[model samples]
Target chain A: MNTELKLQALLDGALDAREIREIEAILAQDIQSAALMQELKWMKAAVAGNEAEVKLPETREFYWSKIERGIAAEAKQAAAAPAERAWWLRFIYPATGLAAMVAVMFVVSGGRTTDGADTESVPEDVNAISFRSEAEAMSVVYVADENGTFNPVGQETKNEPEADK
Target chain B: MPQPPDFTTTLDVQLVAFSQAGDMIAFEELVARHRDKIYARAFSMMRNEEDAIDLSQEAWVKAWQRLKQFQGDSSFATWMTRIVINLCLDQLRRQKRTRAESIEQLDEELGGVERQMPVVASNPTEGLERAELRKRIDKAMTQLSYEHRTVLILHEFEEMEYKQIAKVMNCSIGTVMSRLFYARRRLASLLQSLKKEQQS
Candidate 1:
């Protein structure tokens, strides 16, 4: 803090005893500092109890009526808050449930699947083709030799059609 | 069919108690008693009758809503004054954002303008009447930027300490001291000018 602010703190009784002694010493030695301090005192005193008195221009009933209406409006708003939340919550809960159900179905379905579709990969020396179906729960792999004739190498079926069981 | 309590003679504490118990009449009495002082504080800070009245009324409504939070740590009037002060500060901050500041006001906020001002050798308020002093102070306060004027009002008229003013104004204590110094110096300068005008 500067000397001027120190003088202000001194006037406001904000400084400790040591700082007070220091500021007082400065004030005693410096005429300008002392004059500034006096001016600060005058300003403080002039403003302290001299606040311009202002009255609420409205009558008591008139003023309190608006306050009364305000309190009522606030109370009404407070009371309506929970209902407002519940109104949104009504949609939120069902929407959340629907979203969770859709996510679960997506997870169980293992994304997109093709039924009766075959995928083939041909190597430099051999040609092999593979078939899988999540809908039918089955997989088949076929390999072809240099003669261009294909033969099944492996087959697996988790579920097969039942005639009368 | 029960008669309402006579709130006119009730003490503020008792009235506060009644108000907390959901008695609007008691709260109304409290408002009637302290409304002027609260409005006066708002006016001093806002410097407009319309804004002061609206803000004071808002403060009262807020006080009622937050009555349960009132623990009676300070007098009801002081507590009410603080609510109004905070409201005024909010309003002032909003107003400050919308308006552009002049270079002089910006410089004042940046600090150290007071150091350049020459000290007024004579006391300007020495022989002034109380009402006239108040009038002069109010007029001078209108000339200051909101920050400087607020610091003066909080420290001097509100009797707040530098720390308290800092807390209320949401600034550092160092800033509080600096602004206060500037405010007092500038106030002294303005009062001197007013005195000179009167003399001339």
Candidate 2:
């Protein structure tokens, strides 16, 4: 580095005493060198003065409040996202849809024989059974007893059956 | 364990840690400590109060967002200052696109008085009152082109080394030296004339 730069570095605490001496020897060489050193000294002072006198602007509490709000807003935006995503809806909606599907399937395939024996095996999720008599198709329907027997449904002829018996 | 750090030291570390954890209050403390320097840098670059303030504020937000990457390799203020400088440079680049007038064009015409600076004047700022010195420096500083004033501010006021300044200004070391030399020459001449005006 140039001697003047070395001197500047020395003044700024970026150089050691050995470097300072080397620069000091260079400065002792000529009158021009001495004049330049003096100028440097004064310039350093002027720079220090300028730095000290630089007035920091007035940032009000309100300004800080705005920054705080902006940060908070960013944080809120980043945090609130996954919560509003309806993550449970991602699970529950599909689940409820599956349940509705099972129910419709049960209604579609839950037909039993007249003596209440299941004529067709159904899926594993089938829980309870009900039947509807159709005029165009099977005229009657039955409820299945666990003994693999069927009893005709809508057959409660309380009066006519007793009289016949 | 080492002795407990004092309040400010403890606070600085805590602020960094908290801000890294996305704490606003801690980030605000960091901002409050360095906003003046940040604003001063932006203002020196943009040369407008409102734009400087806005850009500086945006820089702080960015710093908060990017706090995780800070490895504490340097002082926290240094890291933060770099953030603000980048923001200012990005702003300058954007403005260049819309205005269609590069800094070179401006320097060729209007900012010449800075490029062709006079020699150092005699004791320009030595004996001046503090307020007068500030005003004179402000005026002279405004006279410098964006390039020169930016180098001067980073070097003189911020006490940045040539290499650090190159990184901040995104320029080469040779350019940094040239700009610093011309800027100081102009500043010396300006200070001298301001002093003369006062004497008269």
Candidate 3:
């Protein structure tokens, strides 16, 4: 290790017995090293002694009241999240069910009935089911026909089907 | 209701028990007891009054939340101090990430300009009165980089060992030692310069 690091380790009492003896030998013979060690000791003492013990600028009531408000707010937030999640679930659960129902409808209608009649073939007939998302400034349009046929359109052509409908 | 017991006179352990038992007043008493110390620790690390107040309050809220986990292995004040320190450390890390590094931070890899200064034999704080010494120390502390000031506060003021500081700082013990060494050296240099300015 570097000499400075060794000296610092010696001061911090981080050295093992062997390293201590070696540093001790150096300190005993080297007057300069000994003085440097003393300086370091003085520096440590001055810092440790004179560290400022600061007080809160606010009053006791003021400080504790802020903390009190924080705790109450955190508790309120913690309690609110689950309720909010449940509220979201109220919408999400039914939305998910609706999506599942729509998927099932698509699957059931994909085949011909035993009576040789077409099922409610909305998948093939409902071409370009365009959805405009209220949250985002964008619209999504999917091209599908009544026969469960699909045709993807480019961005420029995407508006034509919606306008056509 | 019957008169509540004098919580101000109640010991920390009993107060912790009361708080954990869902007594808000008891938790308020605990906050009153150690708010300054916790605030001081945050101020020492963050060196900003606004951040210190905000983070200290947040720590108290966290302490209240985690009061059930307080097994009393340490004093309530000590436990609370740890929370504030961790909050300050986290805030500092966030601030560090957002802002560009300061000149001192850039020089930290090479131990900074203070490392090249000669050691002054005279004690920088020897002749100053106690208040003045404290004032100078606090001012000088602001001159250090965040890492340097943190290590110094942890090792010198908090009296943590290199190993403990390393764990808290998430670095090896060698880094802690080196930082502590540089911090002290830089502080000594700053103090001497302050003393010289006072003389002239």
The candidate maximizing TM-score is: 1
**lDDT agreement of model 2 with the native:** 0.68
> Interface Cα RMSD for candidate 3?
1.5
Looking only at chain A, give the TM-score of model 1 against the true structure. Answer: 0.58
- A10 in model 2: Cα distance from truth in Å? 9.7
| Candidates 1 onward: DockQ, in order | 0.65, 0.12, 0.45
Off by over 4 Å in 2: A1-41, A52-60, A72-165, B1-10, B96-118
* Model 1 regions more than 4 Å off: A91-165, B1-3
lDDT of 1 by residue, B1-200 (tens): 99877878889999999999998899999999999999999998999999999999999999999999999999999999999999999999999999998999999989878889998998998888888998898899999988899998888887888889999999999998998888888999999999999999
- Scored against the true structure, residue A22 in model 1 reaches a CA lDDT of 96
Q: How well is candidate 3 docked (DockQ)?
A: 0.45
TM-score (0 to 1) of chain B for each candidate = 0.97, 0.81, 0.94
DockQ of 2: 0.12
Q: Model 3, clash count?
A: 6
Question: What is the Cα-based TM-score of model 3?
Answer: 0.76
- Predict model 1's lDDT versus the native: 0.89
Screening candidate 1 with a backbone cut-off below 3 angstroms (N, C-alpha, C), the clashing residue pairs are none
Q: What is the Å distance of residue B19 in model 3 from its true position?
A: 0.4
Candidate 2 per-residue lDDT, tens place, A49-85, comes to 4742333466556557756677778889989988977
Kindly report which residue stretches of model 3 are placed more than 4 angstroms away from their true locations once superposed. Answer: A85-165, B1-4, B110-115
Ranking by TM-score: 1, 3, 2
**TM-scores for candidates 1 onward, in order:** 0.82, 0.59, 0.76
